[model samples]
Target chain A: MSGWTSVLVGDPRADRMVPKTGFTVQLTVFSSAAMAFLAVFALALSLATERLADRWSAELARTSTLRISAPQDQIAAQTEAALRVLQTTPGVGSARALSDDEQVALLEPWFGPDLPVASLPIPRLIEIVEIGDGFDATGLRARLQAEVPGAVLDDHTRWRAPLVAAADRLRSLGYISLALIGGAMAAMITLAAQAALSANSQVIRVMRLVGATDAFIAGAFVRRFTLRAFAGAGFGAAAGAAGIFFLPEADVAGGFLTGLGFEGLHWLWPLAIPPLAGTVAFVSTRTAAIRRLKEQS
Target chain B: MIELERVAYTYGGAELFADLSMTLAPGSFHFLTGPSGAGKTTLLKLCYGELIATSGMVRIFGQNTREMDRDQIALARRRIGVVHQDCQFLDHLPMAENVALPLTVSGRQEEADEYLADLLAWVGLSGQASQLPPQLSGGERQRAALARAVIMSPEVVIADEPTGNIDWEMSQRLLTLLVELNKMGKAVLIATHDLNLIRAAKTQVAARVLRLRGGQLQAAGSEL
Candidate 1:
């Protein structure tokens, strides 16, 4: 922090050599703010995808469902037999049959709330909770086949793998978006600094004539551009966070877009954007100033 | 405090001058007189380390300028004063700031206040301190440039055509200030084409006149 203050509080004597207000200043601030605003969405998307991957991996890996499709009189016996096989397995923690109302509610999104569970010839579903390493689905299926002949065990591997892969890919894209935003900000500030250096060529020559070091001349520009980026990014981060705050909450009706935001303590991440922008501005402007000065000299 | 030994300069496929040797010792006053395109300004630039000699050697304070980098040259310039022909300045700045620029660039802003008032008074520019460079007349701008040059109390003062744009009276006033600086034990080198200004300066100081012509530096023997 002290180092930051030292950079921010520059030598006023040298800084006064160049004019403070110009088109470059406005260009730097506006472009940095715009980039920071977009960065917020990228960050939200990344965090949301991460949460989705974790939920899918944890929920599907630790649980399985046993389905009994047999004759109406034989369905009760098959469900009991499947539950006995699951209880005897090494990794099985608890197994229970889902109630008709619970099963109907599971299908309610597609079939409506008034699903006729008793009249239809539907399979019975046994919810299996895994403890420790969880049961071996292949061995459990063989046991159920021999004992009840119509039961199947589903550990959700086939569906869970693809969903988790898609979520992971989306998270990577989010990170790539953030990198592009940072790169764009650096490039824009560098061009603006180059223009300012060209415009002040005479001033720089005079400064060199008067015994000003390259560091002294470059420091003025670096400090100004860095502060401008910091201020602009501060405003941008605040506005973006506020925009995210007003988004619709994630409910049963709402999907991924509604879930794309910070939750609880994750809200603090946006506060870092201003300093990050300032750092980017400092590096880019310093590089540009030094390179331009070398060419002029 | 500046030495040029057997120096030659060529530009645009033409040799401006060659085998030019001159030495400016402490408290010496010298005048460099030449016609237009005779490399008078170029010689002054070589004296101040602004231009490296194409051949031979130029040294400042006994250090060869050819061996010095830009940073070393800048540090050495703090000990020398240069007043350009056009009187260059940051036009956006006021006259006072322009005059005190040497101190400001050297990180001696605190020293500027103590010396600025007296320097401006001495140069007779105190009344025009708040005016911008564009607002000042030619003579006033030259005076401001001189003030900036001498604000550091350098060991050597080099001026290139300091009176080209001003009348005779203003030219004498500027000469008197340079003469005063010379009396304080500083080397003075002025490059100009005006013979009368050289005559005027000869009356006040024991000055040597050198002429650059036909690719050689020759001593002008009390002709004017």
Candidate 2:
């Protein structure tokens, strides 16, 4: 078999050459488990932020608003004119002026309920839903400025841009966190493998004396650490996934914090952590073993 | 077979040995004798491709030691069984597994299984087979080291002080084993301070003895 295949398949006799118990074993398992657990959380954070960003982008992109700020006597006239202008506008799916009660509810979070809205000269608000590719905001603004002088058109671009950017940045941070976790795990595994190799210097010498190739000697360490990382990461990922599952269900009222869990096939992402950890361990341990063997030689 | 032509070794900017020439033809027997500071072990390491000569060609199985990479040296080492004075073994492994190590590393575990039992018995180590190396007495460790060295049935056996720590009777037993191996047509080279052991071997096998001192190698004449 090829050297890599032999490393993965592992010879029991070859593995027996290394001592079964040592601090490196525990260190590798613990570090892999801890890193994998963190990686699962990072993955969830990335996926959740991606979902949030998309939802905000898509929802905000599909609708806009119009506000008519005018004299008390001219409010009705401008609202009617704004609605008429929007109706004829291409790509404007529908437009409706908000009822006083709806407007009051929107303002209730900042201003307390039961506010006297009719007594106050509040600006009239119009909700515009878009269809297909949506209306060109510049054209719609020009039309509203010409036809309804007191009306202002908002395409929600200003608000959506920053919110989506923030979420996108957060998603990127999550991915960066995952990468850091992977890197940290690799570093820890490398150190552990180096320590194990140093501790087993006598073992290495004997193996070398007995005609063990560097590949065979290194395969023993790589196989052991790889399996440990795999097993540890498996348990860690399962635990992390379980923690995410038991989190409070996503609530529209609870916002992004409540939505921090895998959805559908995204759950499969954590399943890859163990194998990825195994691969990292394999590479790192192999590198460390080969380097140490060369130094010893 | 192994050969060294005008081989010289230096350590820490000082020449340990120079102008050394030797050959281990198939079935030949030779002994290397030297003072404590002499570079006998270093010369043996050159023969097995463990150390590169400072000046001259040291070839193992016809390949120059200087030109062989670590992997190539390892491959060549498989054909050269080496018994160290300290009898290095994987302490965690049992005596049987330790003896079978050469075959195991060579991916010939089946051959190890075939030969391990009889080999252990031949070395008078059958009773200690299941015990660990640390648990074995000095003599048993020496015998086990010899068994391990020959497990692959290497072409030549290079041993450095093979009986360094064992009793006289145990040393004689180990020497007899080496004699039997030489009779079987395997070249053998041993380095030791034990002139008595060399004398004992000369009686049974036509052995050539060489001495290394003051960075020079010379054939010993009537030394014993």
Candidate 3:
């Protein structure tokens, strides 16, 4: 042991070793890069889910519904009276009874377009848009119950709760997926670093005997793995960006997955992945290298 | 200085040496002559704090090897230089780099240029300073190892078969360097099977020759 003055030792030249096992390096990089890429996508999904949930919940939060049903002649009369009542109520932004043509159009997707919507005894629909913090839906329902005797208030709580909960669940799932990807990247990089360290076992011996410290030896491997991870992550991120770029222009798929992709300056979020991968590799490789060195003595 | 008292070493629980006792003081030169598998290298390892004795005490610079932590051992090792038969080198690095490695690992890299030059010149390796370790001849490697060993200006220099793979002329050159270090007040311990080199060194320095054989250590001429 060149009498222990040096605390670091390893194949300092391993950086120039050019990696004879390119396939394994590639395999490891691809595995980590893919996970990171998926993580980027999951992060984007979570953010988008938040935005979507907020838009839907904010727009629908306090809105109530009015369904009027009576004899054809009385239906028009009751709908007019309900609109008048809502207009006079506090916190009601605007109340409009759906026209016969509008009601037919709403049903057109399910029923044939040629249906005579005016002749059917279908309930007259009135949409109540609320813009204030508080709404007296109970009072309005009571008024309609006693006066119109054919009107019911639907405050949208039943369907709105399930929709918001589903969106929240999706956002949570996205975050969980991102976390798992980070874990997998760490594991793969650790394995690759261990393999490289073992391959140069004799090199480590020479370095150790020459007075190189555990830190110096560990630093060389950490730099190598961190740089490799960065390179691979850059390539993967670029590929992901290009793939997302050629995605069908927003109008095509009607929504969901297409809108699920990034927009505007938000596209820059995935760029952090390469550096993140490098950090992961740096930490994992360091831990693994130090553990191996300790085991050697 | 190194002191061993009732020390024993084992690998896989097989004792290589038992209850060995010795002390090396400043400016003293000692030759450890032993048969094969006599644990000469192992004993040197204990002396340098590379290996801890399984039983009893092996102390260097007044600190027991068994009690020294890794960093403490490394700091202790700065005062001791060891040259091995294989002459381990970072083959990718130049001879100068390999020699300056001790300074580098100790974070004294700032003085590598000056000290490295002096070390290479002393070892007669000035010409091979820029060459990679693999490019050097076997004797050159041994010389480079010696250069690396002494570059830190150690108080004690230990060699495990420093002449095991060299010519007679190279062995003499190495022995001359070890004697010079001893004269400079550096304690020297060399383990070798070469009786010729031992006899050569015994004349120049007040060298005590000890032999390890059949799991027992004795003075060379005690049996005679």
Top TM-score model: 2
For candidate 2, write residues A79-159 as lDDT tens digits.
Answer: 999999989999999999999999999999988998899888899999999999999899888888888999988889889
RMSD to the true structure for each prediction, in A, is: 2.0, 1.2, 4.0
lDDT scores of the candidates, listed in order:
0.90, 0.92, 0.81
DockQ of all models, two decimals each = 0.77, 0.84, 0.38
Using DockQ as the measure, the top candidate is: 2
Task: Kindly state the fnat score of candidate 1.
Answer: 0.68
Q: Residues A23-141, candidate 3, lDDT per residue (tens digit)?
A: 54775678767876677778778877877788679877856778998888898889888888888888899889888888999899989898787777789889888976646888888
Instruction: Report how far residue A211 has shifted in candidate 1, in Å.
Output: 0.8
Which residue pairs in candidate 3 collide? A6-A211, A7-A212, A7-A213, A8-A212, A8-A213
Residues forming the 10-long window of minimal summed lDDT in candidate 3 chain A: A1-10
Model 2 residue A253 CA deviation in Å = 6.3
lDDT of each residue in B94-189, candidate 3, tens digit only: 788788777776767778877877778888988998899889999999999998898889999999999999999999999999999999999999
Give one digit per residue, the lDDT tens place, for model 1 in B1-224: 79999999987889999988999999999999888889999999899888888999999999999999888889889989989889999988899998889898787899988999999999999999999999999999999999999999999999999999999999999999999999999999999988999999999999999998888889998686
DockQ of 2: 0.84
**How well does candidate 3 reproduce the true complex, by DockQ?**
0.38
Question: Model 2, range B1-224, lDDT digits (tens) per residue?
Answer: 69999988889999998888898999999999989989889989899987899999998999998998888888898999999999988888899999998888888898987899999999998899999988999999999999989988999999999989999999999999999999999999999999999999999999999999888888999967
Q: After superposition, how far is residue A207 of candidate 2 from its true place, in Å?
A: 1.3
CA shift of B195, model 3, Å: 0.4
Q: Model 3, which residues run further than 4 Å from truth?
A: A1-32, A249-252, A263-265, B222-224
Better of 1 and 2 by lDDT: 2
